[model samples]
Target: MKLDFTLKRFPINGRLKEQSGLPFSCVLQPYHRLPEKETSAGDASGTRSNSIARCAQCYSYINCYCVFDTAGWVCSLCNRHNALKPQQQKRYRLDPTVLQELPEVRSEVFETLAEDPIPVPMPALEGSPAAQQDPGYVSGPAPVVVALVDTAAGEEFLELVRSSLEAALEALPPVTRFALITMSNRLGLHDVRASEPSVRYVSLLEPQLRPGASAAAAAASSPAVACPLSDVMPLSSLLAPVGSFKGAITRALEENMVPEQGFGETSDAEASGSGAAVGPSGAPGQEAAMSRNSGGDAAPGGGVGARSGRSGGGHLPAARGLGPALVAVLDYLKVLQSPAFASVKTPDSEGGLSGHGSGASAAAVVGADHLSQNPSPVKLLLFLAGVPDFGVGRLV
Candidate 1:
């Protein structure tokens, strides 16, 4: 329960400089109290109170570090005096019986109300469909999982993904939301919320090219044309409710696995046989034909073949377009977590500790970047088949 700082001199500006070029950091693990058992009468009044006392100036929670007095308590962090209410003063009285009974005042950690100190009301919808419904219908943010599958991924990898997703269905909470996207020469956005889930395609090949450009130009230009995944479909549609569309999503994964293509007619056959189905829009046998037509001549659909390099000599190319797909998903989530979109008021927002309390400090230290300032929670899960081959971090 004791934290020892190895640094003799603390950084006043919160920046540590070293000549070794490596950042100085320290790991801190806070103390946690065990849960108490219930009583026979089910009246847990003897246990710690639901409400927590906090400093008025810094809003820091009352912990063992705080110095308690008959009139008020002194905050350790900000060194500010906080006057205690009549009830708090009585609870922390000097009597031996009260001191023995109320251990929460002396404990480093204890249970309290799970609610936000300051609550923000959601903006009212004027003309939307939901506006006519119950005025009190409040929609909290749902957990989101986005799976980015590589088209260049082999049949084995795709099969593994399918199995993992199936397992995830049983493990993930019913209220969780899931989205599936595929990357290769192009990006495929699967709208699983629809009655029949289908992938909408977006070409990664750049549009601008000279009259007599070579096949290499196609590969070089594709990164420029790659658009955000959110543009293909709204986030609401892409992130389908797992509880309602688990079956539909499972079927989409089974039917829409795209394989490495544009190698040649022979390799295309092998890819199809290995369970790599053509995109949702294309027919079963059309992928091979398109690959053959696009491979020989750069004039017709050369962009496809060029963007997706040939798997010549029976060697499959590394996955392509993963970087763009990831970027798109990240951008979408960032916007979702922004203050503009997270307008809904949840129970946690109305009942928890203030933003400056120990709760906020813990969250800020744990995952400051991932956790949004807004009360709504956002989660992202990425599944990669292999290294990306076509973007800033491409291996080649």
Candidate 2:
């Protein structure tokens, strides 16, 4: 399918006389819904003779081009995380929406892991038991609850994410509990039980995750619990807890440890060696903790996600750690992509590109943010910031 493409310039933050801006040059990739046709490969000049390259207002790269019949492609410089703000002279940049409304435009809309188990009982321990339970069975294990916390996403994006997750979960046999948390220093968790089941905004213990805050502040404010994705409670019973979620889980699990007894010091040495906090944790390929804050808390109470909190100030400094984020995402994706969580049909399976032909997959949209960095899990976050810009194109 030949999808449409357009360029939209976003304002960049800048000081006097200096101009800065990030341009989102977007292309609507061919999806199942769009019509299909073979694309004529670009000629020697890197583009068809009929197509022309144009400067995207927000990007510094000159590669932004408008093609006659193909998905759009943008330059890397303008769409990065550390993109700078534009200067005063460049302030009144062209809006992406206007460019998209051009004559030929067709209006369209769009949009892991398992771990070892611990023997634990639910708070509702002594109930009437199960219909198919043993004559005198004490209790069965509590079902694990997987709560996904997406940071910096806006309301629409968060809702879309929530819906996607729910859709993904539908394919699973049956899960005990599941929740969603959206954070950005502040918190917004949806009430899973309410009649309308809407997202509730909460006072995030940390402010650093907000767009302007530093990374450090965000890290510090992040909750250690896996429950209630945000800090909103009194406002609603279905509160989302915010803080170092992975930490809380780790800390809770570490409380109970089994001492090792080995025949030789070599075995003992290896056991001890494995437990130390060596260097930094959670680098993409490195087998570190799934979360930066909670290396010690992979397994804890019923595995449903819990909570513990204390308010703090300022944004956490940009830690030189990405491994944990990568690990967290990979683990999450493992579960998300699992047979249990596979709700939507994959693009590749239906014969589009690899896996995004319907282009319904979240990774397709998220990939635009980080695929250029290195084709690993690090790219998952760029879209987590979920600020709406142009769809992903030629400026003119």
Candidate 3:
């Protein structure tokens, strides 16, 4: 392939993203080489593309030819109008002409990421949990809820979880947003997005080596390919208000949520019996195996998910993947909070992104005045009776 070619010189004239005949290649490459006078990538001409606004619909780089008004900017490519982010509105406040100061607007050529601070990529976890299988997970941004459940807790504990979540439902305003995670031997995530309840289980235990397979091969053979958390589920599917999800959330906990049976020092017979009863996803290549169990709790006194007499000294369940589970919950919230994605409308504001529904609304009303001067966008209300014993931060 001819990698190097004549580059479009910057500071030219009229251009639009729709001007396809224009040599985007030349504009993207800029020149055969950096100028000798250049000191660093930061100092290069056309490098300020980072701050250059983009058409949210077409995602085309903003160019000089596009029309910008106080309300929004028209996409040069698709003729779509996209609202300006808060900071972009500031530029419009100063002078619309300032928008042209961007290198892409002046160059009449395509910009490139050849220089700029590339954000460090997040480390891969596993095939995204159950939420990702559905195609419409992030169709658009919305609110989110991650119910972190300790599956090892007994019936009383589960009753508390049920009652608490039910109460949370009553207190929460309507919008379809929720995900329940049951942590025990594996991390079980509920598909609260749907009307029919289901939980996708992921074993935290390291996969046993397959006979006659190399370590490298074993690692590569995982059934689910690792992807960024954002791609794990659809934003539209992930978020919606509480009122829409009250029934489904309640049903999910009652019908689908259950503790993994073989946690800690259970007898071999019990492990075998329970494993036979509950069905596992058994997806190869991943350390986690998805399980969905319907059997009643076997722990003495009929506790929800806990074993009454664990041989282990620790009071905590050995199988609860609390650490990694918490990480996943936070990541979900963080993704929703991001402005680049998860754009949501609030009751107070017609446009903009919201990380939490009720919380966001509360903040808008009394967060600053009554709550805290510096209110946190995401507040994690975790329900755990014990520490984690599996995956990233296993205490045992």
Q: Name the best candidate (by lDDT).
A: 1
**Model 3, 4: alpha-carbon shift in Å?**
70
Ordered from best to worst TM-score, the candidate numbers read 1, 3, 2
Tens-digit lDDT string for candidate 3 (234-337)? 33333433544556667767755544444435443323222222222222211122223424322111112232222232333346667556655565455444
* Candidate 2 RMSD computed on C-alpha atoms after optimal superposition onto the true structure: 22.6
Over 4 Å off, model 2: 1-139, 149-163, 205-383, 386-396
For candidate 1, the C-alpha RMSD (Å) to the true structure equals: 14.4
Tens digits of per-residue lDDT for model 2, 1-396 = 334435353344344214443333556555535322222221122323222222355533222222221123333344332222343113212445533433222223211112335443322221234311211111222132444343433335544554554454454323123334333333333333221223333332322257886665655555422333212231112211111122222221222111111211221232222332232222111111122244233321111211111111122311111223323323433332222211233355344332111122222222111111212111132224323211111011
TM agreement with the true structure for every prediction: 0.52, 0.22, 0.41
Candidate 3 overall Cα lDDT vs. reference?
0.47
Worst 10 residues of 1 by lDDT: 357-366
Model 3 TM: 0.41
**lDDT over C-alpha atoms for residue 75 of model 2:** 39
Please list the C-alpha lDDT of all candidates, in the order they appear: 0.51, 0.28, 0.47
